[model samples]
Target: MDYVDTFITVAEDCAAQTGVVPKPRGGRDTVAVLQHRMISAAPYRLTQGDVLFSTWLLQQGVDPATVPPEDPRRAEFFAVDRACLRASPLPKTHGWGLHFDAEGRVALVAVDDPRYADLHDSAGKVVKAMRSSRAR
Candidate 1:
């Protein structure tokens, strides 16, 4: 499933004052790093499903060459409910927001960016990213 005309705001507990680029750790790219790479490089080029699936594939070390876009594997992968962008670390901890266009394409918006407010106000729906920690 994808969010259309929606904006996912940063988590309430997010500490970063502005969007911070995620960095790889332990000589490997973390999920946050992988997600950041994808969305940052091609804003509005992919849907929430595409980003999640692609990241999952990468994490599983699945070769894209072997799994074409039309491959049944894609359908199988999405058969179960998966976490949405509101659960993404970009918004949860990295001070970034996720904006889903009318076509359901997604792009990152820094929390401090003027467009963050613009999109939040103008989007058809708004959802806050999942909190990073349990509420006190």
Candidate 2:
């Protein structure tokens, strides 16, 4: 679900005390790396849907140019329930927090950044990132 005026804090089980920039593994972008690239490159410019769709497109090796909004691919993709940013590894492992503005545009904030603290304390809604592992 898209969150408006919400701040998703780092997971309680996250080990990193500060935000760590995710790196490509095996010279290929993993989901976390792709998300980091997109969110960091354009803070608050893209909504949750935009980030999720773009990342999925890149991972599928589908050129976005070939799949216009009118294409059925997007509809087919979203037809099934997809996890939201709360499940994203950025906040769960990479020490980044996600802030959704009033318009639901998302931005990345480092866990240790003052802005994160401010958002955590002041956002209209606050939620923690989903834990990486199930609790024993």
Q: For residue 47, what is the lDDT in candidate 1?
A: 94
| Candidate 2: Cα lDDT at 101 | 97
Model 2, 30-71: lDDT tens digits are: 999999999998988889988888889999998664777777
Candidate 1, poorest ten consecutive residues by summed lDDT: 62-71
List per-prediction Cα lDDT, in the order shown: 0.91, 0.91
Q: Per-residue lDDT of 82-112 in model 1, one digit per residue for the tens?
A: 8888888999999999999999999999999
Assess candidate 1 and give its TM-score to the true structure. 0.94
Q: List the residue pairs that clash in candidate 2.
A: none
What does the lDDT come to for candidate 2?
0.91
54 Cα displacement, candidate 2 (Å): 0.6
Candidate 2 global TM-score:
0.94
**Per-prediction tally of clashes:** 0, 0
- Clashing residue pairs in candidate 1 (N, C-alpha, C atoms within 3 angstroms): none
